[model samples]
Target: MFIEDIRNDFYNILLGNRVLLLVHYDVDAICACKILQGLFKCDNISYTLVPVGGISELKTAYEENNEEIKYVVLINCGGTIDLVDILQPDEEVVFFVLDSHKPTDICNVYSDGQVRLVYKDDEENIPNFDDIFRDEEDDENEESGSGREGLEALVERRRARKEWEERRHTLMFNYTQFSYYGKPSACVLIELSALASRLSQAALWAAAVAAEAHAALYVRSPARCLLDAEALHRYVAAARRHDDSTANRTACVVMEKDAWLPLYREWTLEAALSHAAMLAPKLKLYARSGSSRLRQLLADMGFPLQQARQAYRSMDVELRRSLLTALETAAPKHKLPVPTKATFILQRPHMSPLAALDAVYVIMALIEHETLPKAEGFQLALAALEVSGENEAWRKGSAAARRCLQAVASLVHATLSARKLLLAGPFSYFIVQDGTPEASVVRGPLWLGEAARWAAGGAARPLLASAATDPHTSILLGLPPRFEQEPRNLFGAAFEQAATKSGVTVSLDNVDTSVITLPTSQRAQFLDALTALLA
Candidate 1:
């Protein structure tokens, strides 16, 4: 069911049809949706887009919008779950799914002509169809014969079918043992849409942010992130060659070595260093001496106290330019690893450059905005992705992102100070009390993840974090303590396995399996099961 030809088998097939586009509520999906919308506009393809949060919502959206639509395109969802069985669309309907969620449902992988996977990941070793399925020929043979010889053959066939079923179960469990993301869906669409053509800046930035979202969320491995960057090098090269001397200003994305700290460019030197994931743990920021250690490191880097305390933009030009080199030089003495990385920055004529990492944070924050309606937040997120002269959307999202990060840092400090982060067998965990200032902030998975990673001092074990959503229910998220080149998450599978044995009803309703919601009262029991499962 995997389509080899993106244009012919996927794009061309939807040229003149009315399509129902169901996009998941995530930064990557929003960026991918924006690119697909552009592609659809270019081809004059009629489509209705509905943002879905989970499986039930996806079904509802599809059923409501699929009245007259024969071609449906799903962004970032519906791949890991059985679509045809759940949606139950008419025979004429053909679904083209572009989900980055890995370990796609075997049913979807081998589905008949109705379900078509638009993108195929080379990393997935999907079992052969025959290995996982056997026809009902045994029943057919029994129906067609009754003689002793036929009866014996039928019994033999039944035994063979049972063995095949058992093998299939094992194969499926091994295949779906973990959940992770593949390449950004936006990157795939951009590549296939361009068809070896030069890269478009707007589309490229979207792709870059989408890729960074995977990294920022730890859903994609560092090695995979590098591969995502390699896929966009041509675009960066083209942007580098473009002339920005024209009257009309255009944004250009360029690669540069910068700090790994998110939103550092927009924050003051002291604040960025203090809250940064890499430096915070290394500096032991939760302890009383954390401040002196930070000042000492800055002093060692030769950054003046005044300059270090001021906004990054207000810092002296020479100091700003040499920041990376200074950090690299002083890092070894401070027991800090080199924190600089070659990353993308959006450059416009007179505007401050925006980091792709920052963009990911911005969009994610907007989408998870507490007060704003989801539809409005969705629009705001799309607008934020646009690198325009008057980037009001970007500014708004940036402000929200900053607040979110500050809350995460605050929560991490509070948790550590209160000695709430406790080890639970195979994982370490902390809970955000209901009325805490940052409890609302950490309720969203992205912010909670940020808090979790920061709180995981040495990242000694896989971390599980929970935030109270209500008196009866709480949301829990699991994360690996640390990952290197290959970040395979065992948490998703762990959550499900523990749920089965725990005898507690937990909801793994989110598209990302790492996140779940469970009864507040039964959380301790669920944790015990998880501990037992992981142990």
Candidate 2:
């Protein structure tokens, strides 16, 4: 059943119950899980939180922790698949799912009472229950009745049912043809909690980071992100009432116009402008004249060459304050997009205010860290998101994010220079060879997705990028085209079809349908099949 009133139907229902919270391993899910945990703690509701990476991990976590868990809550997972079919929970056990992935499985959407979904997206055209289901009593009666005329009626009824079934199949195919994010699940939870008068700083910050995650990954549209954050602005106003800037070093959450560069505050401004995905291509940083053009842009903005090269934090205070104005006045002449927008920031006394986008990269690096177990990474990410100072683990994750961005820029430049990106019938693709310099860095789906976008340039088509893990296997990441304003990826369904049609051995273990693992031996055949299907 779909939930319309979250405070009444979802929050109040779990007030006194022991809940099993299974969260997926991702940046947005981590933030959403933290928000829920804070809300649960305040109400004195006992719950066990487990982070699951895929369907198999989800099942194992549910079975091991479901001792007396009658109310189960899943975040960013278990929505695309049938819950009852997979979990087989007891009849009394109710599942509350808050997943951003779409389209939601028909079984869950049409479930009677045991399952409840906490998301509502305006774009999703869910099928009507009558269109997809039929009553069994009528069929039984049609079978049991006896007579010549009755026999003819039964045949007619069966024929009608078959026609309805065929139509239902077509409707389902169209609905689930693409996989995309709806909104940040954390922001949804925060909005509902505020309706119940249960808002907190931690929850607001978490929601902010989750919203930034969507924008950073390009999984959600920029307009949608701003629309969803409208509700969050009210909370920020209330939270920012009395605290002065230097009061005991208390952390303050503020919304203000800042540069769109990812980590310009933490990193040097020059590096950020050159390597950030939003600015790199716009500045034509790959060409030989790119550097001189950048210097000229800065000079025309009245910013000194030395100040532009220095770390943003160490740059003169007056010049730092003038950046947004300078860019607004001069960036357009250089054919660059607007470089400033109002974003959420976590500011502490006598330190740099951390932007939501900056926090997203750090948290994501922790969750997908090469050395840490996913469960441990989840813990580290949660701790890192606190208002307090960063621990050693947090610092390590920040360093990793910098390296990852450098590798992404490196791979994008190498691919463009070598002309390795290939254009096919309906899509474009680039491969990271087995022993390439930055091949290992782009192995993770998130990194590869960033690389694919960078290499896509101005082409209005999906880009598929693969990184070889070994001679036998490679990992694939799919992204929407550059011109797609809403950014719904078609490759999720296309990958499934191509794998089956090509007879390739592939693994679809991740909750993200756009990522897949297949043998290197059959890469060509799989591409041929995918091209045909997409065409």
Taking all chains together, each candidate's TM-score versus the true structure is 0.94, 0.93
Tens-digit lDDT track for model 2 on 1-535? 8998898899899988899999998888999988888888788999998999888888999999988889999999999889999989999999999999888889999899889999878878998999888898877786865799879888999899899999999988889888888878998989977887777777888998998888777787878878877888878887787455334347777888888887887778777777777778777666678789888888878888788788888999998989889878878899888788888998876766788888888887787676777788889888877866556766877887888888888888777777788998888899898787788777777778778877876468788999885678898878877633668877888899999898999888778888898998888889999999888
Candidate 2, residue 514: Cα displacement in angstroms equals: 1.9
lDDT of 2 at 440: 73
RMSD of 1: 2.2
RMSD (Å) per prediction:
2.2, 2.4
Error of 1 at 349 (Å): 0.4
| Per-candidate clash tally | 0, 0
lDDT of model 1 at position 352: 79
* lDDT agreement of model 2 with the native: 0.84
Question: Model 1: what TM-score?
Answer: 0.94
